[model samples]
Target chain A: MAGSSVSWSERAVRLLRRMNSFYSAGSSRCQCWHFSVGGMEVGLVPPAVLKQLRRFPEVFSFKEEKRLELNPGLASYHDRSSAVDRVLQRLREEERFTCLQGWRDEKYEVMPQFSDPPLMCMERAATSLFGVKRYGVHVNGFTRQPDGQLAMWVARRSLSKQTYPGLLDNMVAGGIGSQKGIRDTLIKECAEEASIPECIAAAARPVGTVSYTYEDGEGVFAECQFVFDLEVSSDFSPSVGDGEVHQFYLWPIEKVKDALVTEEFKQNCALVVLDFLIRHSYLHPDTEPNYLELVVGLHRPL
Target chain B: MAGSSVSWSERAVRLLRRMNSFYSAGSSRCQCWHFSVGGMEVGLVPPAVLKQLRRFPEVFSFKEEKRLELNPGLASYHDRSSAVDRVLQRLREEERFTCLQGWRDEKYEVMPQFSDPPLMCMERAATSLFGVKRYGVHVNGFTRQPDGQLAMWVARRSLSKQTYPGLLDNMVAGGIGSQKGIRDTLIKECAEEASIPECIAAAARPVGTVSYTYEDGEGVFAECQFVFDLEVSSDFSPSVGDGEVHQFYLWPIEKVKDALVTEEFKQNCALVVLDFLIRHSYLHPDTEPNYLELVVGLHRPL
Candidate 1:
């Protein structure tokens, strides 16, 4: 077992070297990851495992490099070296290990497959690889009602998951994992999170793709996000998904500003969705020139 | 001998797979190499090798890919994989047989240090990879001259080269692989090709990067180009590199346009360089509004 662990460590190092060589040759900028978030220690995560974490925000934050540590529970799995070692160890030692059978069940619908080592590496390093593909619709304008202004639909995430859990997120944000297209993911996630009908989701037009990197206490995460803006009636009501979401709310452009400024909205959720709104002129640029500029400028680099 | 050939072929396949996987995962868009250019076959050059080509286009294009096919004496090297296999067999048969020592010494300066199997495979496959990198820059209007016309510095590429040899190209243009930084490469190439002094090159402001894929009989090629717009005095005289260039001329915007359209300048060279001028409004937008719009819109999708 010790010899096997040593071999796995050597293999992990080799994989990392290959990855580094590939990245260095290309011009695309790469972000680094530290394992833990805030005051947590996450050193148990192998460097190769942590390397994959750089792609998702739910798991990593580049800006929080120094504070990145390991999850304490991962210490037992440290010497295992290979990902398979850890998985097999868990199966033998834990009662709930049998429940993890779903991870290997290819027969299950909508479940991710983990048969390939490199792919499994991507899955275990969940945050960076969790870019959900979705369709974006840019609505031109909205009308104000007596009580509130009518605009398109958007959603806030349930805080239970990882990173920015309870924050207001995309109107329809999702991760584009293996075997899923952006359009299909959008439709599925929107339906699950907002109770939006599949037909309406299908009608959503894609504007373009926006990629960004966000770092926090978790680890450095990258997102190749698809932004969609949709127009719904003023009388429309939202039904939140009990499984994926905590609640849903409709805000006028004015109220959105307050929600965004306060901690109500997730990191840049308001900015990205609002930028799409202003670019298509869905909201009056004059009322919130500063917000429009901020959002639009965020899409561009200096 | 047959075993060695099979091993080399397997290595080539492995390298190709790795290249394909890397590009698909990271780049915005990528096209596979399926055509041969000059003497080289396609889909053999790895990203590192491609980057090497971009750096020293003069050496790589002139000596490596270009000379291998265009030079009749070297034409014997063109039997594809079978020819490579035979060459390896010959090297094995004659223990003292060293492979092209003279050619190796000549190309050593520009050739990147790569490993054996992949490097050998790249040499045999004759493939080229091309793509675009976006270096976004904001351009303001250009200054006009006292002669009642817009004065522009037209650059001439080194004459001792391939493709539009000795003709005017851009205010400045060079391959990205010339050096580490785009700014540094542009400065060096401009200084060498057009005789723009180091002091002036230092002041040049970057406009943007233009990426394009070009394929001819030689091979598939990709270029990540950076263009800059600098203000030069109307009376500014350039000291051209006599060995590589004949002279440099500062022309009125009108003469430049006529030269570009009439093929008085090299074909497409005028169109591309002139398009940059128009897109940035260095030329009068009202008089050439259509031309301006066309060029600006050309880069929108990219």
Candidate 2:
């Protein structure tokens, strides 16, 4: 929030504020419905989504903070049982909302559970007004040459894809769907996106994450990407196993950096690449002007 | 700032807030000097330090946001010039201030400039009353057995050392001193702390960083450790190259994890090891409940 000699323009500030805003700033003025967990408001989802939830009267209730509560009593109908997910699926299909990313078992992380599992995953939560946490895994695939040069395998999304059609992507990237955990989803994506074998896929290191809560056209996006790095043998070559990606290109690290400056890479993939460059020593505090700001800004506070 | 079901006690909250309070939390009420870069206020330092800083009026000045600017003109001195360092040295020698961590050429990292080097190194800016970014290299030293079980080499600081005496530490850790760049400093520390040869030290991969701003009796500390991971050969044994370490112990990663929960490891070393654990897949997201949090919290914003 503190501006310095940087001197960002009003337009740039507004764009940044739009991309980084978590709850609608000055939410008190907005007629929004709060999304709560264990009686605390985490977010204020769009009111239209609340209107749709009216059908499930027994599952949700309104209270303080203009809050909408997911009743603990509904735990009996875990989404795994197709109870609540079934209702959301019906709404997606019947109402024909464009936001539904299909009937995948997407689990929206709610509260922390020590010994036991979370009460339930928020199925179809991303497109909802709720500020439920969604997890994803992004893998940086690279190979080191005998001469010590590093080359990364980058993916180009198919034009037919729903989001960011034909955009450039990391070697492998996918959501941590309810069907699989973070690592599992990563391994699955590695296989599906780049045909990386299971043994090699498991070698991917969980480096860290880049989290941000921004509002898009759909709703609030409180996304946290658990990043990983996979160093494939120089002899290995990747072939797309899934139709999601159009093709793969192995570019020198320098080329990747150039693309990063341009708008050639997908939005989030650029951040992942920046993280990779930092860890690999390609980028250093002394070598990067906005070193501290870039590092902290990639993982901003919600 | 929003607390949910994840509520900590007032004491725990204070401890966390103190350690992570990099940004001014509407702390405009407090009378303090702002440390800015570009046009941004990175931190607010105590006035007592400002009073001390007044001795070298050429180095720092006050402006906006109650701002104290590290004069760009002083960058020409590089703190290598005895003129500025001598004054600070004298103050440290005569004042009997508990915060001085002794004289060293600390790298005060500034903007990137390939054409010319940074203006000046921190040159012992850490223990100063003003909060400036302090950089260090923390290496997670470990060996992989034939059976694939991982064990880490832990260093016990020599009881006579200046700080955290007798406390457990990473296999190698040291400040990015003014004399050398980050990589050179790490290589030097590896040699000085663990007799690791230049060839082996070069193999250490530059990982990411972990940042935190904490307030202690020593004024305010805004620290960022450029982390590294070195997979030492199984045959190699580490011996104390200097008197900084009392002894070295090679313990199972699990044992290290157990000790992490206790006070056996120094506050910061535990975090470095945790970062290693996550990277090595020893502490996985699926098994560890605070897995996501631990990863994100380790690399805090600013």
Candidate 3:
């Protein structure tokens, strides 16, 4: 299993680099690429920017450049002022360029408006808003109610989200590329997205990382996700971040699965949640539904 | 296991640098500090000569100098030049420097001589004399004897070796940083060290790497060795390189183990050969001989 994870990570890295190269040729300014190095995720800037950076001996040194090249997978950002202007023009047409006010909680904030290409906008949102691309681990904390059913806390995304607006996700899902590892990311995401407290996050135990590729009309995307299992008290209530998350729902596992099958859950929310359940063997053993096969094969015809 | 090897290599590298530093400071000319990059071996020049080298950009580039600071372990040479000169200055002192010469081929014209402080010889002879420190994979080839025993073909080191003169070693072993992986190095090392045909080297299969630490009275060294396994016809006769190697030896497993225990094998030769056997479980399963433990613990008393 460890070998498989390493292989997957290697493949993911290759795919990411290939994607970066493909996208880089089209943009005037190079995009920032992130990759795992020495178990830590770091961002690399484009060669053009790096060349300019070399001139500033005080801020950067050539010796440091040699050190960075030792790990070749790190990505770099290129000059993109013109590209940003073009992206901003597109944003004006969509009326989605309104700046958001900072939220009351210092750590929790709405995505800032960006006048840029959708891809550039997404990159900016991921960096300036979410910080960086990271591996996210999710744990499902649940217990049997008096009625003999398992219940889990789920967070709903705000309708303002550009993608998957008004959809349910894991109680905590964030990138591991952040300063912290999976546990820290989970706590931070849960607190900011669902308002889960430190006490609840502390009880979580990491299961493993679940990886999947997601693509829309925009571009290809990959995520290294982790899941943790936590058992919260029956009466546990989470304070949802109003600016980021809309509401919180505590539902039985069976009901979640039912919603997935009945087309009740939003977008790929059901599939993602179901994937987590099946991976952890939370579902009944005898019920061997081929949901993954169906979902994996489902693709919009080009 | 990989992490442990990295840490061990790092520690060995640190000790080696410290040893070089001590030798460098004691020398007047400071010429004894010669380091190579691309390959991590350091060459110690005599203090008087080393002073000339420090200012000679034609001989050593600035890049090589930078690499020395980054990876001190590659510093293979220490100004043992003065030591060698002192020994050569007196007939009795010359005896202190052990001498061994191995023929490169049947012509016996180009025999390479290795000394304790290695010979400061011509470039071609020097190249073959120096052990290129690099990563390598070890492979074990097998053949059945008429008596129903397994016979292994091992290379005999040249007599003029600084260490392990006239010792038997792996069928193939070479430094890794030479822009060659295990397969490539095996082919080259076998050809030069044992006179094996290129076709046979091509047929060898890499099994694994055997990493070990060696400390002589002078300095500590670490090697990332790759092991390979091959099967040959029983009638095959190894063509020995008289210029580099005196002769070839084929011994059964029992004789090999016996030689290791009796110390009949050359210095440090037993560890390389015996460790390969133990790691691959070639020894009888029922017999619990702690040969590796014994040899590894036999540290030189300060």
What would the per-residue lDDT of candidate 2 be over residues A228-297, giving only the tens digit for each residue?
8889998887788888899999999988876754445776777788778876777665545445455555
DockQ of each: 0.02, 0.29, 0.01
lDDT of 2 at A114: 21
lDDT of each residue in A8-36, candidate 1, tens digit only? 22332232222223123441224333334
Which candidate tops DockQ?
2
Please state the error at residue A253 of candidate 2 in Å.
3.9
For each candidate, C-alpha RMSD in Å? 20.5, 7.1, 20.8
On TM-score, the stronger of 1 and 2 is: 2
> How does the DockQ of candidate 1 come out?
0.02
lDDT string, candidate 2, B156-235, tens digits: 99999877899999999987654457778888999999999999988887667767766655566767787888989899
Task: Name the regions of candidate 2 deviating beyond 4 angstroms.
Answer: A1-34, A44-128, A142-150, A187-205, A231-238, A284-286, A298-302, B1-33, B36-42, B46-97, B100-128, B143-151, B178-180, B195-200, B234-239
Instruction: Give interface RMSD, per candidate.
Output: 16.9, 3.3, 24.0
What's the distance in Å from true for residue A117, model 3?
27
Candidate 3: deviation at residue B211, Å?
A: 30
Candidate 3: docking tier:
incorrect
Residue A99, model 2, lDDT: 70
**How far is A224's C-alpha from truth in model 1 (Å)?**
1.2
What is each candidate's fraction of native interface contacts (fnat)?
Answer: 0.00, 0.41, 0.00
Query: Where does model 3 exceed 4 Å of error?
Result: A1-134, A137-139, A176-180, A261-272, A279-302, B1-302
Residue-level lDDT tens digits of model 3 in B1-302: 23334442233323333322322344322322444432433333333333333443433443444332113232333323333223223422323212212212111111111101232222221221122222344445557778876777666667876556677665555553322334566777767766778887676654323333342322223333444566678776666653566666777876665555332354334444554454333542112322212212221111
Candidate 3 chain B, run of 10 with poorest lDDT = B106-115
lDDT of 1 by residue, B1-302 (tens): 23334442233223222222333354422423222333333233333334334433322342333222122232332333334434434433544222222112111101111110111222212223222111211111133687655666665556664446677655555443311344566567667756778787666654333333333323333422334566666555666654455556677775665555443354334434544454333443223323212332222211
